[model samples]
Structures are given as structure tokens and as C-alpha cells.
Target: MNMVQLERMKNDKGFIAALDQSGGSTPKALGLYGIAKETYTDESEMIQLMHEMRSRIMESPAFTKERILAAILFEKTMDLKVAGKYSADYLWENKGILSILKVDKGLLDLQDGVQLMKPIPKLDELLVRAKDRHIFGTKMRSVIKEANEVGIKAIVDQQFEIGAVISAAGFIPILEPEVDIHTPNKEVAEAILKKELIEHLKNLDPTYQVMLKVTIPDIDNFYEELMNYPNVVRVVALSGGYPREEANEKLKKNHNLIASFSRALTEGLNVNQSDEAFNHMLDQSIQSIYEASI
Candidate 1:
């Protein structure tokens, strides 16, 4: 682990840029960025376009360490380059921002009111590659759709189990057990998730610290105590499906939790915009999220 990056992560007054949308979510991401699905005929072409979009964002002056503590990257992005340097290296060496790789394959079928991560075959091999690329951490996401105790416990257990592996590999893990924002019993699900998370966090070894990325809670300061846990490095909120304005408002009500937004961060940015227009829109987005964070 890089000690400098670790300290910044623990104390930075900024949000995380979640630029890690994967194959399953890429088309929608691109479409929102003004590239329709019909424009890309195949998956490879689609991925390349997505990379181009990400590269544009990374190279923009508006996307910098001033308001962004770190960036979460997809596996393909991790392997690619920005400005002729590896993506992670470019983020750290040029922009002074840390990098985290999204390590989960994707979600499994919804079962027990939740969706766990698909099995990551040869996860250690992937970790080895991430480490070689100057990655500071890793993120994996699972979802909670209901308040079922059995289901929520299973989700937290799976997150912590994989988190331990990532920790042992020398990368901090951002364990994300996202509660569905549209779930009918959202608050109940969040309460159950908090309970399950606390129980697992209590049992974690002192040497293994982790970060958390969760949906903005229905109640203000719902995860405040979780943020103070000795084993927790930082607690970040995912934008989920919330639009940028709504997400920023809700994030401000929660005292110390910072943003790790994907869609909300890129809400108005389109590939067709000129450099000046794109940078202006991105600047506005970053500023709003940064203000809400602090």
C-alpha cells in the first residue's frame, strides 16, 4: 500500500469519481453521453468508444485532484492508457489522484432478496495485475433489494469475505452492498444492511481496514457510526439512480459521507460537446459534488 495515498484517502475533503461502468452498463452510459447504441455495431467497438469517453474525462482540466480524491476504474480502463501512460499511472503521476479498480465480474441472479457478485475466477491473478499498475484499492458491488435478514447477512458476508482477500493482497477494498433506491421498503432494507455490516465489521481483524460505498440513506446520518469504526477508512455514497441535483442534496444532509457518483457525475456530459462546453459542464458537476461532500 502507498502510505501517502492511504493518508489522503482517510482525510481528504473530496469525493470519488466512479468511472467504472462495465460491459453490462456501458451502452446506457454511452447513450447518456450522446452516443447511441446503433453507433457501435459490436462489443469491442462499444468498449473502445467507452474508453474514448473515459479518456476525454480524464484529460479534462476540470477532472483533477482538487475535488476528486480518487477514481474507481473498470478492468478494461485499468489496462488501457491515458495520454500515453497507463491509466492508473496517469491518474497518480500527472493528476495527483489515486486509482481503484472495480474487481467484481458483475452481479449474480437476484436470490434471497439480494444479488451477490458473480464468482471471480483467478481473482488473485487480477489483483497481481492491478498491483503492478499502481492501483491503490479495489471495489466490488452487490445489491440489497429487500429487508430479508438472511439475504442481507449473506450480502455483507460475501463483501467482507472478498474484502479480506483484497486486503491481504495489499489493496484496500471498497465493499459496496447497495440498497436499491426504488425498493418499496428502502429504509427497512438500509437498517438491515447497517446491522449486518456492523456485525461483520466488528469481527474484522484490526490490521484490515476497508472503505464502504452505499446508497444515500433514507434517514440523515444513518451510517455515521459506521464511518467511525476502527476498521473503516472512509464511507462513500453511491448516486444510485438519483439525478445530480437530488443526489447532491441528499449527500449534504449526511455529515461526513462523501460522494462516489457514476451517472450523476456524468449526467450532462455528452461526447458531442466542444472542449470548452465539455469542460464547463464537467467543472460545474465536480464543483457541486465537492461542495456537497465537504
Candidate 2:
């Protein structure tokens, strides 16, 4: 493990940037960036355009370690070059930002009112590749749509099970069991999730500290205890479809939780904007998120 990076992650005052929109979410991400589906003829072209957009964001002066502690990357992005260096290398060496890879193979069909992550085949091989690329950690996500105890427990179990493997392989694993913001019983689900997570956290190996990426709890500081757990390095909140403003507001109310936003981070960015306009917009976004984080 990179001890410097680990220390920074444990103590950084900035938010993480979730730039890891995979195959399923890429189209929507592009559309929000002012690129239409009709603009790309094939998967290759779509991926290329998506890369271009990510590169643009990464290269911006505003996207630095000053306000962004790390970036979560798609596999392709980790392999691809940004400013003539591999994305992870560029992020760490040039920008001082750590890189985390999104390792889940997306979620399975809804079951027990939750969507558990699909099996990650050849995970060891991927971890080897990620480590070679200078990636610092891994992130996997599962979703909870209701307050079903059985479902929520299943989700947490899977996350910790996979997280243990990732940790054993020498990378911190960010276990994200996101509670759907639109769930009618969102608060109830959060309560159940908190209980399950605490139990799992208590049983984790003392040497392996993991991070968490979850939805902002329905109650302010509801996750305070989770943050204080010795086995927890940090607890970050996903925007989870909230508008940037609302997400920031909610985040501010939760003292220790920081943001790991996808859409909200790139809310007003457009592909056609001038460099000055683009950087200005990104600067504003970064400042807002950073302030909320601190």
C-alpha cells in the first residue's frame, strides 16, 4: 500500500469525484454533457467521446487535489491516457489525486427489494491490473429500494465479503450500499442499513480499514457512528440523483460525510463550451462541493 496515499485518504478534507460512469450510465452522462446518442455511430465511437469528456474534466485546473481527494475510474479510463499518461498515473503523479477503480460488474436484477452486485469474475486478475496501474482502491455498489431486513443484510454481506478480498489483495475497498433516494421508506432502509453495516464493520479485520460510499441519510448525522468506527477510513455520500444544490445542502447538514457525486459534479458542463467558460464552471462546482465537504 502507498502509505502517503492512505494517510491522505484518511485525512483529506476534499470530496471524491465519481467519474466512473460505465457502459450502462455512459449514454446518460454524455447526454448531460451535451452529446447526443445519435452523435456516435458505434460503441467504439461512444467510448471515445466519453473518454474525451472525462479527459476534459480531468485536465481542468479546477480538478485538482486541492478540492478533490480522488477520482473513481472506469476500467477503460484507467487504461486510457490522459495528457499522455495513463489516467491513474496522471491523476496521482501530476495532480496529486488518488485513483480508485470501479470493480463491480454492475448490479443484478432486483431481488428482495435490493439490487446486489453481479458476480465479479476473475476479480484477482483485475486487482492485479489495477495495482499495476497505480490505482489506490476499488469501489463496488449495490442498491437498496426498501426497508427489507433480509435484503439489506444480503447487500452488506456481499459488500464486506468482496471488500475482504480486495483488501487482502492490497487495496482499500469502498463498499457502497446505496439506499435509493426515491424509496418511500428511505429513512427506514437507512436505519436497517446502518445496523447491518455496523455489525459487519465490527467484525472486520482490524488491519483492513475500508471506506463507505452511501446515500446521505434521511436524518442529519445519522451516520456519525459509522464515521467513528476504527475500521472505517471515511464515509462519503453519493448524490444519488439529487440536484447539485440540494445535495450540497444535505451534505452540509451532515458534518463528517463528504460528497462522491457523479451527475451533480458535472451538472452544467457542456462539450461545446469555450475553455474559459468550461474552467470557470468547473471551478464553481469544485468550490461549492469543497466548501460543503469541509
Candidate 3:
């Protein structure tokens, strides 16, 4: 599929599910789920788990084509075909789930209340591959833990620069500058993030349109200012470290935002559970998260 088809997919489906976990974060997720580190050492083992998870999701009626508009995927899982027939993208698209690629390499060392993603070399090559694979969009992330103007400016500049490149290539870009939920001054940091984001976006070429995945703000309707921007397609919230229930509570306050949560969305699912048990859990998760989105 080309960019035009991808845009159609986005328009036809409104919600997105983020399943992208890079190498650095995968270990943390495994540990959280009590999966032994050795299980992920063999690349095949991890791939198998991802495949099964996707299978279960597609099997569930609750996670129908209309419910999950798209799924954000890690690089390794991008080309994987489910049931040895449909590519991950095709499999989901059959059910109305557009595919989105996670493009950032990973994060760098924490510096003064912020951390930037490591630079990706030959990013054009990756974008080409994403296009060939029929992915509808791409996402990259950086973290802001405090209200430092210098750090925030740098983060905003880099995201818009990358986002511009992505938009030019015909993929909608999800620019995620996640503020840490644990920050002592989360409200302050979010206020600054919104301001910096708006300023940079206003200066961007009118052709570039992007989505935002930010932390659920500390204050209600804090992101209203951002949603008003013409270039922003939508605003989605990350779970940060919050549990599912708490995350849902906060999400309900903001009528404009929806969820792209990872851990919180999968909090109760276990890889080792029986088929019935697994699907039951996934059903609950989909129900809760879907309700919160609306």
C-alpha cells in the first residue's frame, strides 16, 4: 500500500494500539511480567510470543476492526506474517488495523531532567522499508522530566525535524515527547511542553501533519491548547508508570484525548495463561481501554 492508502486507513479507523517495544525496553517489560530474561535471549522465543499475542488479539471479537484502528510495531516484528499467510500489516488491515512503525533507535543517557533518543543512521532507508511494508505511519520518542526551556526546545526541534521528514515521505508521524508521570512538577513540565510544541509546530510547513503521544496531564484539559492546533491530527496519552485503573481514571477527565498505552493496557495479561483465560483478560483490557478512549 502507498501513502494515499495509508491516509485512508487512518481516516477509516480512529484508535491506535502501541505494541512497539525496543530491545532496551523489552527486558524491562519481561521482568515486569515475571518472564525469565533467558526467554528473550533467543530472538526466536521473543518473536514467537509476539506472534501469539497478535493471534489472540485478532481472534477476539472485542478487538474488532472498528475498535483498534492501528497497531504500532517494533522493527523486528514489522515483517512478521501471522498464521504463515498474512503479513502483520495485512492481517491487521484485514480487520481494519493500520500498521505503524516505531522509528527511533532508543534513548540516550539521562541528562538534566531529559533524555534524547539515540540518532538513527540512514533513516531514509528505514522509511523506504516502512513504505514498502504498507505501514501507515511512524512514531519516535524523547523524554522530558522537568521544565527546562533549553532541554524542551532541543526536544521539540528534533521531533519536528524528524516529523517533517516522515510527513514528506507520506507517513503520518506520531511525535511523542513523554513527560515523566513521577516528575515532582509534572504540571509545570506539561505546561512548558505544550507551549514549546505549539511554537515549533506553528513554524512547520503547512504540509506536515502529526499525532502526539503525551503523558496524561496533571491538570485537566491541559492539552486543550495543543488540540486546537491545525497541524495536529490527534492527541493520545501514554500510561507512563501508572496502573491501568489509575490511568483510566485520569484519562476520563480529558474528553479530547485517547489512549496509546503499553504496560497499562497489558497489565493483567499473562503469556502462560490458558486460551480462555488469556482471551478473557484481553477482553477486559480492550473493554476498559476502549471505553476510556471515547
Candidate 4:
């Protein structure tokens, strides 16, 4: 199948596997890993909203100009059956504008009912599908070698299991720090920030900034904490989940140095600030960070 088709059906399994295999194994590491998973919820509602948003995606010219694309947020199962039902192009020899590209079978148990669209080499084999899918730009970010004309990078919502997202999309992740079963929390997310310390500061090649779309009680505290890590590629605080007035108020003290999203879907302002706008605003913001860091 072609890569375009892969993007349509791709999901975030690889991303999770990488996080699980971070090898830190320390209490702090394990605790941070768990925090990444805190934001995860079942994909039922999110999936439903994705379909609605997809129909409306091409509706807005601004969103289209931004190259805003939609992606599947997988939770274990790559139900080819469902994919076929929604857009059978996934199984066909020909991948389409709306088809599945990459998949994260790393943490999945096919015997447990998970089926991968394009199987990848587990155990660090790196048997990537040349025409299947691209990769996530954050974390498992080794796609620069393989990135081609068709290899448009991608970034899925942050997750405890984000290796798959990075593996398939090649884009940095945008985080919502409150609590989701699949995203990184303050401690864990902040902990990962340490990777920047003693590392490449604006010297990581593509870019050195770190892009994390998150919420914070105090942007100053969050911003200040980042100062300790001079190795950061760059930091973007996307904490629109808080009360708009409050979020704006908090960020105002910080300044516009970081590109923040108002928790909007890029289609409209977010209410209750649910992640329904993920594919467009969050996804796009994360992509910006990936490019900026590179």
C-alpha cells in the first residue's frame, strides 16, 4: 500500500511502546511513564468526534491551508474490520487520501484481537514499510534518514505509549498535562524535559526546541522549571484547557515567546477544552515545534 493510505489509518501504538521501553526503570522513570498514560481514555468519543471533524475539516479554508490532517487514535486494536467499514481503502492494494498508513504493533497482542495494517519489525529490527507510513518526529525520531517526498512527518497526541506515534508520524507530540491515560503528567513530562539538560541546545540538528502542549496551574512555575534545563530544543506551553480568561492571564505574564493554542480545534474555540480539536490545532502545533526544533 502507498504511504498516503497509511496516514489515513495510522494509529499511536509504536509511540506507547517506546515510552514503555525508555529503560529508565527507576521509580522516577516508572512514575513518569505512568503519568504519560494518565491522560489516556477509551477512543470511543474521540473517534466519533474525529469523523465529525473530518467532514468539517475541508470546510474551513484556513485549516486546509495549514495542511491539517486527521489521524486515528488507536487503543490497542487496529480493527481492520472497522477500518474497512469506515474506509475500506485500508485493506485494498491502493492506499487513499483517507487510509491507514503506519501502525504500532509493538505493544499489541494480535492474539488479543489487535491486527496491524502494516507489520513492523519488533525487537529493534526496524523493518519499516518503505511505502507504508512515515513516522512521528518526536521521541522515536530517527525518520530523517527515511523521510522522503511522500514522508510527511506526523505528531499524535502525547501518550505514555508514544513511541508508536513517533515511529509512524515523525512529529513531536503535543501534551495535555492534567490527566489522561495516554499523556504525560507534570512530573513525568517535566522529567522527560531533563533529556534536554547536558544535551543539544539548538544543536540537535533539525531543531532543539521541545514542544509540549500542556496545562499548568502556574505558567511561571512551568516556564521557570524549564529554565533549569538549558538543553531544551524550545518549549511551547499550550494550556488552553484552563479557563480562557485564566489561561490567557497566566500566559500573558509569560509573554508570546512560546506559540500557545487557545485549546481551539483550529476550527473554533474549545469548550470544556476537550481534545476534540486534536488533529488540527494540537497536531499542527506539535508539528510546528518539530520543525522549529529541527
Candidate 5:
């Protein structure tokens, strides 16, 4: 649950599959399979659909072969049951896929196209449940669209503050301060983000290691320092809506970070495909992502 546990998980050298879609994102992910939002008019029905989708994925060779070392799960998927067993247990016992919980309560809008993760009420209680469930770590998202110094600093401070809380409760915190790929000033944003992150990490206790999930930088060597930071277990990239091939190409050029991609990882996969076809598509995808990661 802490750095020791996270370091053990990292020894496996495989990418993390992020399937932690929630609320509107959940239905959007389902739509990839021609599933309509109306099919799940209630929360319970939606959860069932998500559970079924995850069950099929976990049963595949992509998982069984250990191509995916970890999976980031939405709250519903984190608690999902398969054959009367918690899905996390099923994956860990059967396939060596460690489970991670997405603890952010979604995003709240701020000005200038910036957003902060909604505060989780009773977050301490959530961490306790996650620890009991054997979840490996936690991930949350905050975004920077256009970097104003004040806004960027605030984003960095808030993330580390929450990250510290999560780490103290014995979870490896993945602090995601996503610089939107579409921003015209992505280079500047990455510069500012890198500076702020280093300052914050310097102040962090050396005992608590953390992870960072950020947008692929547009400039070369933009994150060199942070990538090699001693307390950073891994620096992972988010797809941020890129297609699988494009993301892979960009990822291949980066030497120090691996991926925790969601949409890009699932781009060629489809629910209507036969199991064999699904496996083939997924295997190819995982192989490419794996290659890029290393």
C-alpha cells in the first residue's frame, strides 16, 4: 500500500491499463461497443455493464499473459463481483494484475479552462476500504489548460496535499496534473508544471514515493529531471484522446516513462468481436504499448 508495496508491483515491468471511466465517461466508453446510454437507465444497470466488460477483459490472454501489470478501476469496478469474488481478487489470484482505485470524485470546473478534482468527503474512510480490498494504489486527475503562474501553483499544491494524505494512509498516490494536449502553450505549461512538481516533491517525505501521470510533452527532455527524481517510482503518460498508433509513436520517443493509457489502449478493441478476435486485437495493442513503455 505504500512505497514498499508499490516498488514490488513495479518490478514486473508491464503497463497499467486504466479502465476507470465514471459518470459521462462511463457511457462514452460503453458507446464504443454500440451500447447506448439508454440501455442503462439506472446506476445499478450501468455498473453491471461495466463489470461485464471488465470480466471479459480479465479473462483474456492479455491479462493472463501478464502484459498488464496493473489496472486502474472506477469505484463501481473496484467493488465489482465475479463468481462471488471481488474482481480485484480474481485478477490478482488468477492473472497477477494488481488493482488500483480511482479515488477522485470527478472534476469541478474552475476559470480559464482549468479544473480541480472534487474533494472526496471522508477520504480517510475511502482509503481504509481501499487498503482492506488490497488495491495497490490510487489515482486522481487535475488539468492545466493555459498556464498562469497562480493557477499552476495552486494545482500543484492541491495535488501534493491530497497525495500526501493518500500516501500517509498507505497508498501510492498517482498525482495527475494533465496539461491539455490541445493547448497552444503546451511547451510553456510543461515547463511550469515540471518546475512546480520538482519543488513539491523536494518537500515531500523521502519515505513516501509517488507516481505522476501527465500529458506527453511536445518538447524534448521537458521532464528529464522529474523522470529521474528519486522519489518518483514511475512517470507515466496519459493518451488524452490520441489514437493508439499516434500515442505509441510519441511514447516510443520518450525514454524514461511508460504509459497508463485508457482510450488509446482500447482503440482497436470491440465488444462485438469474437473472443478470439478480441484477444488478437488486445494482444497487439498491449504489445505495442509494452514496447513503447520500455
Candidate 6:
């Protein structure tokens, strides 16, 4: 929390030496634009940088959330119990995230495509504690149904869909800027690079539209293949080294890493959880998109 201490240690290359020291968290898209003034707009290079950081994370034994917080947060030997339920009466706090809760009544695609949504914190086991704050889900269903009313088709995370036939899914294909692809040894992938992973992941997504994280060498080697995906929308920092839509200018200044809003807009609506405001926003964005689209 102390900027002074952080600044002091930042000079010690050895401190962060264990991780992807090659690329610092990265200047945000806006910040990059501000600094580069030019040349930073090259997305190919930024893609490589993302893989570099991912490799570092995968290679480090110390950074894993399990290992890093093992001492207390989820101590291997301690009780993992927290108790409360929504069976009792509940009241609205009105206090919520997002200054304005925008409603997106976007037209949904009833076409049975694998509409990939963002992963929710609901890990299938624990009941979300923030049930009182559930608002997004109600909105999403309405949108999906609305999409159905139109002739547009859609589906959720399907195996395959082709051409404009894939257009009606009520979801936009989002991009994942980076992914952790450790080798069989669970270390940084050396013999195999980003390409192999991309090649391999290319098949994993039933929808065929996915954000891939592969090594740089892989991208370099399989440049043709990566560039050739029919529906892939490569992850680009919406505000980073280049303009999201333009892709021809420097990122804005002094910013560090941030999620791509365009990607998140679609990823966010996939689920609803009691505590996450982003999830609700995604949901509403989906609706808003549909409403506006229709």
C-alpha cells in the first residue's frame, strides 16, 4: 500500500525476478497511446507481450492463488466454513455498483450457437452469499426471449456454427487477451510455444470463436493459422497501445493493465451471482445491445 516502499523495491530487479519480469503489468492502452505517440499501435507486438506475461505466471510456483494464500486465506488445515442463507426476510439496500444501471434490450439470437458468456463466481458448489443483490439474471432472460421473438437464432457455448448463421446468438464473440498455457511439466512452455496452444485451443471452443493465449514463438510460427481463424476476434486492449476500433494509434498515457470493455460486455452477461456488479452490468449490456440492435 505504501508507494514509497513499492517504488523502492521496484528498483530491485531480483524481487520480482521470479515472475514475468520481462513485461511489467503493462502500460494501459490509454497510457500506451499517450507515451508511444506512434508505433505502439502494433497489435502483433502487444499480443506477444500478453503471452510473455502469461508464461511468467504459469512458470512461477509462488504466484498461484492456492500457494500464495495457503498460509491463511485457505489454510490447508483450517475450517472453510461461513454461514448465512436467504431463507429469511430480505430488504433492498439500494446501494449498488455502477452509477447507472443501464438496461440493454438487445435482440438475442435464438439460433442455437454456443454463446459464450463470462464465467460466474458460482463454482457449482457454494451458494453465492450475495443473493440479495440478484438483478442481472432477470434482465438477461428477458433479452434471450426477446431475441427469440425476432427471427435471429442463438445458442450458448455450442460446438460449431457457420457464417452469418452464427450471427443470431445474441452474443458477440469476445476476446481473451491472454491465457496461461503451462507445459506438461506445469512450467513455462519452452519446447512448445504459443502456436501449439492456439492450435490446440482452436478446437476447444465449440463456438470456434474464443480468446486464445499462446506463446510468442507460436504466434510467430503459426502466424498464418492464427490470422486465418474464420471467426476469431483477437483480444486487443480496448484502451491500450492502440484504439480498439482504429488499431492505428498509440495507447493513451500512464495507464496500466485493464480488461477490454468490449470483450467484457459480452463475457459479463453469461451469468448472474449475488455479489458481482460486473456480472449484472454484462447482463444488462447484453439486453441493452439486443434492445438497441433490434
Worst 10 residues of 3 by lDDT: 5-14
**Which regions of candidate 2 are displaced past 4 Å?**
none
Q: TM-scores of the models, in the given order?
A: 0.99, 0.99, 0.91, 0.34, 0.95, 0.22
lDDT of 4 by residue, 31-115 (tens): 3222232333544533433333332332322232122222222321122223333322321322222222223333222221111
TM-score of 2: 0.99
lDDT of 1 by residue, 1-294 (tens): 999999999997899999999999999999999999989899999989999999999999999998999999999999999999999999999999999999999999999999999999999999999999999999999998888889899999999999999999999999999999988789999999999889888888999999999999999999999987999999999999999999999999999999999999999999999999999999999999999999
lDDT (tens digit, per residue) of candidate 6 on 148-252: 212112222221222122223222222222222222321223223233435444664455443222222222233335544544433222221222222111212
Candidate 4, position 128, lDDT? 38
> Which rank order by lDDT, best down to worst?
1, 2, 5, 3, 4, 6
Give me the displacement of residue 186 in model 5, in angstroms.
0.7
The alpha-carbon lDDT assigned to residue 244 of candidate 2 equals 94
Off by over 4 Å in 6: 1-120, 123-193, 201-206, 213-224, 235-294
Clashes of each: 0, 0, 0, 48, 0, 47
Candidate 4 — number of clashing residue pairs?
Answer: 48
| Local accuracy by lDDT, each model | 0.95, 0.94, 0.77, 0.30, 0.81, 0.24
Residue-level lDDT tens digits of model 2 in 1-294: 999999999997899999999999999999999999999999889999999999999999989998999999999999999999999999999999999999999999999999999999999999999989999999999999988999999999999999999999999999999999998789999999999999988887898889999999889999999988898989999999999999999999999899999999999999999999999999999999899888
Pairs clashing within candidate 5: none
lDDT minimum window of 10 residues, candidate 5: 1-10
Candidate 5, 139: how far from true, in Å?
A: 0.2
lDDT of 1 at 182: 88
